[model samples]
Target: MKPELQLSLQFADARHRGALARHRVARFVRAALETSGRIAVRIVDEDEGRTLNREYRGKDYATNVLTFDYEHEPEVVADLVLCAPVVEREAAEQGVTLEAHYAHLLVHGTLHAQGWDHEDDGEAEAMEARETELLAALGFADPYARG
Candidate 1:
């Protein structure tokens, strides 16, 4: 049986209000998840993103995406935070569409929530390969691919 999914999305940055649709994000999350549970995706400004990163991750700078996985096993529960400004900047720098970048991040975060990691070379390679496959299945290009 397919796992059940409960997804909630919040856009704290109004500047990118219509940049991504809820359904598209849901699709990406669903595709990347191995099991189902509640997942919250929030789009925030750099300030909030940086604050969260500093407090939770000890990083002073805002990042493109942050995943907070609360549970993984019988069910998966997590929160994914995306810094709108950082994401936009990176998307432009990478020459990919905003939606595509968001999709990639959603998939990446979902995988993290599912207990996937990249702290080592071998793990990173495996995770990237899975991400590439999932993105391609979703009709997006390999996110790690460079021009």
Candidate 2:
């Protein structure tokens, strides 16, 4: 059974107005959740994305997705921030659909909120395996598959 989720979605960047519906986002999130959660997912433009990344992660550029996880027990409480333009660029570069990319990132962020990480080779492999499994279950191709 999928874990219960209370999701609050926001689109600071209107460019993705019709793309990321609440049900779709929730489906992506729930697929990676091992516990119930209160998650806020925000989609932002490059500037806001860069600013948040710079302030929170000390990185000067916008990243695809950032998970600010506050809790992992009983219930996971976190915020997932996705950079829209970056995601679009990546999808185009990777030859994947925008919907597929969004699903991948939401799953990635949800896993992070549930305490998954890819800080090293072993961790990365495991995390990727998990992500692959989850994505496949959702009928998506392996995100890390080599061409």
Winning candidate number (TM-score): 2
Local lDDT at 131 for model 1: 95
Check candidate 2 and list the clashing pairs.
Answer: none
Stretches of candidate 1 above 4 Å error? none
Q: What is candidate 1's CA lDDT for residue 94?
A: 95
Error of 1 at 2 (Å): 4.0
Measured by lDDT, the strongest candidate is 2
Error of 1 at 55 (Å): 0.4
* lDDT agreement with native, every candidate: 0.93, 0.95
What tens digits encode model 1's per-residue C-alpha lDDT throughout 45-118? Answer: 99999999999999999999999999998889999999999999999999999989999999999999999999
Whole-model alpha-carbon lDDT for candidate 2: 0.95
lDDT of 2 by residue, 73-124 (tens): 9899999999999999999999999999999999999999988999999999
